[model samples]
Target: MGDNIHLDYKYLSSLFSSVESITFEQYIINQKIEHAKELMVYDEFSLSEIAFKMNYRSVA
Candidate 1:
């Protein structure tokens, strides 16, 4: 919640006047997923830890 960069995620839907190819939410999700995959290289990080680190409410 506090650490999220896209804190105004919902409101951003109107800010983007162009770029209809992808929504901001989709972009953020993709970036987070890719980041999680990159973090997989480290042996110390568990899936739960990664989820929490990413500010996710659940590990789904």
Candidate 2:
């Protein structure tokens, strides 16, 4: 994403952390977790499917 914006990833992450009080990676994980919960509520996918969709290596 930072590459698309022509900024170094480390710099972008630092800026994001300064403004959001959380690391950019953590923010992405939080978003993925929230999306997984929403998908679970809809009952449209299995746990494994959700994990895969969220880019987790495994359902573990």
Candidate 3:
């Protein structure tokens, strides 16, 4: 898993280097949505837990 993370980091760094510019808000939103999906599908954490982890004020 650590090796995978290293590879993923390299890939992301390459992507960022290639892109002329990036929006932090869009990136954060996309990551949060992906994480929310994972939390829902995996059922490893409750909605509130996921929301809190994502820095959301509420599940609503």
lDDT of 3 by residue, 1-60 (tens): 237556675567557656836554466678889989988999999999999998999999
* Shift of residue 6 alpha carbon in model 2, Å: 2.3
Q: Global CA lDDT of candidate 1, please?
A: 0.74
Per-residue alpha-carbon lDDT of candidate 2 for residues 1-60, written as tens digits (9 for 90 to 100):
787779998898899999999999999989999999999999999999999999999988
Which parts of model 1 are misplaced by more than 4 Å? Answer: 1-20
The candidate that achieves the highest TM-score relative to the unseen native structure? 2
Residue-by-residue lDDT tens digits, candidate 1, 1-60: 323664564455645424556776777888999898888777579989999988888889
Worst 10 residues of 3 by lDDT: 1-10
Worst 10 residues of 2 by lDDT: 1-10
Can you give the TM-score per candidate against the true fold? 0.61, 0.84, 0.57
The residue ranges of model 2 lying beyond 4 angstroms of the native Cα positions read none
Model 3 reaches what TM-score against the true structure? 0.57
Candidate 3 root-mean-square deviation in Å: 6.7
Best by lDDT: 2
